[model samples]
Target chain A: MAEKVIAGFTVNVTEEGYLTDKTQWNKEIAAEIAQELGIEELTNAHWNVIDFLQKDYAETGKLPTIRRMKKEGGISTKDLYDLFPEGPLVKAAKIAGLSKPASCV
Target chain B: MKKLLILGAGTAGTMMANHLNKKLDLKEWSITIVDQEPQHYYQPGFLFIPFEIYSERDVVKEKKQFFPKSVEYIQAPIKLIEAEQNLVILQDNTRINYDLLIIATGCKIAPDEIDGLEDGWRKNIFDFYTFDGSVALRNKLREWEGGKMVLHLAEMPIKCPVAPLEFLFLADWFFNVKGIRKNVEITYVTPLSGAFTKPRASAVLGNLFETKNINIVPNFNVSHVEAEDNKLISLDGKEVEYDLLVTIPTNMGDQLIERSGLGDELNFVPTDKHTLQSKAYENIFVIGDATDIPASKAGSVAHFEAEILTENILSYIHGKPLEAHFDGHANCYIESGYNKAFLIDFNYDVEPVEGTFPLPGVGPFSLLKETTINHWGKMAFRHIYWYMLLKGIPIPTVPPHMKTSGKKL
Candidate 1:
């Protein structure tokens, strides 16, 4: 589903106003999540990961594995990008709005 | 020339109505479902309400919205189930007869069951088992700055046993968002030994508590709460004080179950584990929270039970032997805050072992472990619950049974 682009920006909160919009996906939080993961803003590299994760899933389908993600990025060698210090799974999954895997916790 | 009467229009009743509505010949068999409440609630979403992830609109819809058009819905409160005469009395003292009765009357959270619960409920203490309560708790949480918050389960056999844990997990995420996670000391108090019932599950969940830094006060049997003083007194005489209390009170089956002389002390119908037939009356059957089945009182249990119950009900009608095959299979997603979740799949005999699910070794989703895949799977379930499960339409690939195909031993 396309992100809801509602009317006005009601005081786009920064790190200082953490309590402002915790449960929702705002531009600021998304940006923070993106920045923490070193994902370049609005690039095909970033959008590709986001779009693939957005599809409906079943038990049979394969997850976007590290190898697959690397191949899809059109990189010469699959480099494990050190995005967030707290594990790629946690940082990538959180930004993707996926559930915290039991193994990850 | 027998009629089937189903009580309650909640998840269990709705599933039974839909399942039987399609199978039974409408020309010969008449099916009527009775429920006092006019609306149906997406109960799982209630867990997300306090985090403001879900407004009331996201979790609630009309009861008639889900009921099959073929089944007759009686919007009246049941007074009693007169089993001997095979008739049920309405609150107005009107009676309707039935040859076969399917008791789908689900459980209710009786906060009043616990001492001091009724007095401080919804004001100082709140439960998310209901829509109104969830909304109130959400407002309370939003206004909160920081304090000692106690998330409690008054007793077991409550609808959705995993909800309270989900609350704590989300609270960790919620408090972090508010920059007050460290400020708000969250303590989860449950009657069970660990964070959950099964030892393995509790261990997995217990580890999560350590990771989140949420305090776990296990085996603290609550004697009563002192809301005025903002304290909980356990049976063992341990007192844990809280500034804000989130409680899942003692849940009981519908009062009509007791009124009918068909239920046990808790108003839960005494049912045969495999048959789902009421022990007291062979012609009567019970499912969902209404039955005293030794299973997790969750929606998936009800779904699995409905599948077996439908086959049994039909078999009984045709003078065939009832299939004693329901394995108490249940699956739940534990939402650990910070956008992570865990999934568990188990049946009556099997413990929740760590492994991948549905497809076993090649799962897109993992089981008994935290992963983003499980988190998305949990969110995806909301859509599945509305579109497939309640409508008696099974998910394309997932079977009713807890298959070991993809699960690691």
Candidate 2:
């Protein structure tokens, strides 16, 4: 996982297909995913959080925990769910450079 | 005995399956039918859907419901067909071997084929061919106040030839009933050089277009739809501006037909001009929109061909010579709106002539003529199609061969 800031928010980016192993996506595909995520824009403030999330998930086998999200990304469970209606934390985790947990779906 | 596999459970295939199921004995032979989609759409009802005359419930039925009970139904996606090997493979890796194959797969919509069509499609512009599109248009019409409205045919070889015209006519009626007739300007755009394909019918209906104040944009080949500008620009750059754009999207054949490499550029199977047999393979036959026959691709044409092809299949079963005897016969009822409709019956050689049908001069229905009886006949066909056509039961009074009786010279 590659932890990076995207659209003023922390997101973990990883290779496609694995819960833990995410691939490096280019700016265009990243922007498309961001648009789908309602982020739409990639700003300097978002870079670090996205990079950290990506790096942490890449280093570890799972996405950042809520405690980690609160400590690192400054987002609550409610704020996470608000971003991803299907459970923002879990759903955005799909695009956030993290692994898709089997039980998450 | 040779195995027979039928593709598609649509109008033609379902009817053919029922017809063949009754004739072929299972003790000596095996019969199978393959189709991807489980639901069978009442295609004709798509016309009424936009006007809220019919709902999604009325336009759709399960394909399995209309299929013959005895035939093996393979509800799976077709991967590819190796005509040379006389086999069709499914996506599941199941191979269906057929000594005789019937391609009843119908034509499909190809909106992306045209330039800029994909942009406005279903959003700024609409097509009533599909269930979703029709229902969407219905919803759009609900909130619509009124403006320049256009009923345009992108090109010919559409499923129902009269449907676009019928839409325009019905729109007029619908607007009038809603008391928005004055606020809206209705236009009928076509690529044809005249009001219709046939000259006699064109002169009559063309006059009606004039009288009803429905602007006719004849010979306009649409190049693209400028949604932001709210204009339909033709190939020559002639533009028709509209507030609500209702277009009949381009129609093409199935993708499986393309994968099989047995079809033309449009994926419609190349078939015998007269015999209705597949040109690529000897043991294969085709009917309906799936075939590249130079005939009007309509339900009536399929009904006409079914009567003739049954005899041909019977001959083939007995190891006899195949029959080359099907004139491209088609019959359609033109809904002129206001409780009146005109019936047109003709073949490849004969254009629709003004006359009494069935028994000629003594008949109840008139051709190229509109009456209350014709409108009733059109409505009554819904019942007949469900009971007779899909069941493969014969239609009384009307025959496959078109009659010229009561028709004046």
Candidate 3:
């Protein structure tokens, strides 16, 4: 197991730096992690994506795919890409305090 | 009596041996096949290894298992092909003369071409092209949590051009299965401007990349790998950082082809795209990854080429003009994760369009659209490759020619 201190909170991670424990995540932690990842501020629009990803993942134990987000999360394709420059699912899932979603890419 | 020699006992060579053995008279013609590897690897199965969908045992078999008993097998690495003298020189200094030759020595992944790739290979950077590489990568992925996972293609004309995208898809599935999906950032970097080489398929696959949240770094002509810094630098001074990198390196034809001075700049035999015959040598035929044809470097293309080459070879032996022409036909299964896959069938003239395959509007398989049946077909092809294809038995209804009966424009 690996560990990282993000926003002054110690979290267990995988060797590749994925959060091993999802329960340690919170909005403040997400904000700090987002800031570390180079996102200056978390807008409501970003939170809308993050909150939906978090709740959906908790409920289903799966990260909703980009298609699923577009269908159910009510976010347009353009907005989703805008929220996360190169990795929308990656960044959104991180801010939502969850691990990555499995295959389709 | 005449001797027909085949180089390499891979997909193309093995199939050619079976096809010719049945067609030629044993009393009149003797056939010999040479290859370095003792085992026949089902190349497509390499994709399933890292995902744990396949094991090494599933992909490997004794090369002799497929060769007909009458055909002589020489287990030796080729040193050179003395094309001028119609002879092949083996590494052991033995020579074999032939009246007709078929070059099927397939392409190989050349990692050393990119600076710093050899230093990080199998440590942080890995490829699935080799059996050992796939097994090593599988072990790595088993323990890896995920962070900035990048799947890259060093250049085009690699075997199964769609495979890199498939790996990205399967990685998504693999991480999700491990419950670390949020931790992995999947990105696809390619030399091509789009997701695939073909336009329509590129658009569809590109959309899938976006929908799957797999980032695309297009037009990335990789100049080198900075393993210590965890960056891939392109020729134009761009850099992409990665925690784990899975790449298909620059693919080149057999070195023996280069040593013999029989190949082009990349060591690929210059082949007549329509005839499957070597442009430089009249009596020599080229198949599969060995040929510098515009067709996709795929098993299906080799199978299709073998059919035409079979007829052409028979004509050449009889002192008749070769009438058969290859259409650069290719078909492949694109696994989109989950239980669905897409099937595409095309020729030199046609691109993969949406429709049913092998039938007009009544296919058991769908083309250019994802379906569970296509996934089953893709899985089922392993059996077909071993039993029907390598045996030279023509698959019913799946003709060598690309038909437009079921395709939608």
Candidate 4:
């Protein structure tokens, strides 16, 4: 674990930059993380996914997979990819201030 | 007399039935096992079928042959599990009440879940996850002239998560032996960020994949398959063309779980990861691929779960605390082709590391490294699975909980 400054606040994160403590997250922090990951702006579509990921993780103690995000998060696969390019679930979880989705090793 | 019911006579259910048979008092309890299928499949052998290493005969066995004499076996498809009422209704509306229930109804591939996949299924695209699928694929591979072969995994939480990797490794060897290795270009497509999920194992296996000349396309969440175009379309509109497509479709739990309203998004029962008890019902327990426990859905995991589950079930019966806990221990043999295999041992928190198994620094199987001895261990497991594993016989020196003593950490 390492400490990184996001939105003028130092937060604990993994080597890959995923937040170690999800509770130390805010909308401002999300924007900063997203910006660092190459997204210049955080849109409502991105917020919807981030909100769903945080709420789902809080309730289930597990990050939702891309399939779960599509089934339960009311987002289509294409839209998810459109919102977070490359790896949707991985990127979305990172921006959402959640640990990386286990996806079952 | 008290009634204890076991559902689905697959590997997990059969082992539980056998474990409880000797442990439970026959005079005080009556054990009944139910399953629709008459033949119990050695599912691990399915991995060998496509490569023609094992036939249908080797994997097939009579379900009744393993059951103890005291346990009554019922052959009927279950309609629904009335968890609230502690009743299970069969397809014919046969109602059976139980004091305890063990849900071991394992998962199956739903190829129909993906759009346009059915149109090419068994024609150009094939799956080796099932008996019929493996047999059909074997037939197709028998005469395949060799072209671009793509092995795609539809989603995660699949049964034996390593099977897809094993399939590709074996295919590499199979084609090499058939002298078509030069002609067939193999590509592995996965939804994960890498070849395997765990970092250490992924690095090791990913290197092996490169050494075998297999291409890997990671983070490819498939949106649909375009059978007409002979192309796989990812959610991001990325496409991969293939001459022959072998895919592991989305695996979901038995529909009976869904009908009973006892499952999660994928119809897997919500189970206590450590205790093997159903979170929804006190009288109910879940094991194997049917449980949403975040463990790899493999027979080896089930074998480990059975040991802990047997003790927990007994504790539940006696109204005591569930002491035994499953550590998500999973031991798997990865067939890497050319009569060599890799053995992996890990639990909930541990990833597979290089070490010796059963004995530390002794003359035997090596872990996280490809070796002929590990391949022989995998071959020998067929006998152990049949003669000992299902019969509730403890495998000597191999405990249910993963031991960290020999592990390098």
lDDT of 1 by residue, B1-409 (tens): 5689999888899999999999998888999999999988889998898898888888777888787777888899999989999999999887889989999999989887679877687777888888888899999987889889899876665787777778888999999998988789999987554575455666566677888888988756577888788899875467999888888888888888877787755677878877889888989999998987777788999999999999999999899999757887888888987778888888866768788777768777788898998998888888889888888987765677788777656
Assess candidate 2 and give its TM-score to the true structure: 0.77
Cα lDDT of model 4 by residue, B1-409, tens digit: 9999999999999999999999998899999999999998999999999888998899999999999999999999999999889999999999999999999999999998899999899999999889999999999999999999999998877999888889999999999999999999999999878786656676677678789999999888898999999999987889999999999999999999999999888888988889989988999999999998878999999999999999999999999999999998999998999999999999887879888898777728898989999999999999999999999999988999888877778
DockQ of each: 0.01, 0.01, 0.01, 0.47
Tens-place lDDT per residue, model 4, A1-105, is 689999999999977788889779998999998998888899998999999998887766567777788788888877887888998888888899987755333
TM-score, first chain, each model: 0.43, 0.53, 0.89, 0.93
Interface RMSD of 2: 27.4
Report the number of the highest-DockQ candidate.
Answer: 4
The CAPRI category of model 3 is: incorrect
Q: Measured with DockQ on alpha carbons, how good is candidate 2?
A: 0.01
Writing each residue's lDDT as its tens digit, candidate 2 over B1-409 gives 6688889888888888888888887777777889999998878888888888778888677788887778889999999889999989999999988988889889977888667766777776888888888999999999899999988777556787778878888888888989999999999887654566445666556577777778888756677887778888875567999888888867788998888898765677878756788877888999888987767788888888877777777777788888747787888888887888888888766778788877778667888887889988888888788878988999877888878777764
lDDT of 3 by residue, B1-409 (tens): 8999999999999999999999999899999999999999999999999999999998998999899999999999999999999999999999999999999999999997789998889999999999999999999998897799999888656898778877888888788878999999998887554575454665566578777888989766677899999999975567999999998998889899999998755688878887788888999999999998778899999999999999999999999988999997888899888878889988876878888987779988998888999999989999998888887889999888788899887
Residue B381 miss distance in model 1 (angstroms)? 1.3
Ordering by TM-score: 4, 3, 1, 2
TM-score winner between 1 and 2, please give it: 1
Pitting candidate 3 against candidate 4, the one with the higher TM-score is 4
Q: Please identify model 1 stretches exceeding 4 Å from their true place.
A: A1-105
Off by over 4 Å in 3: A1-105
Q: Give the DockQ of candidate 3.
A: 0.01
C-alpha TM-scores of all predictions: 0.78, 0.77, 0.79, 0.95
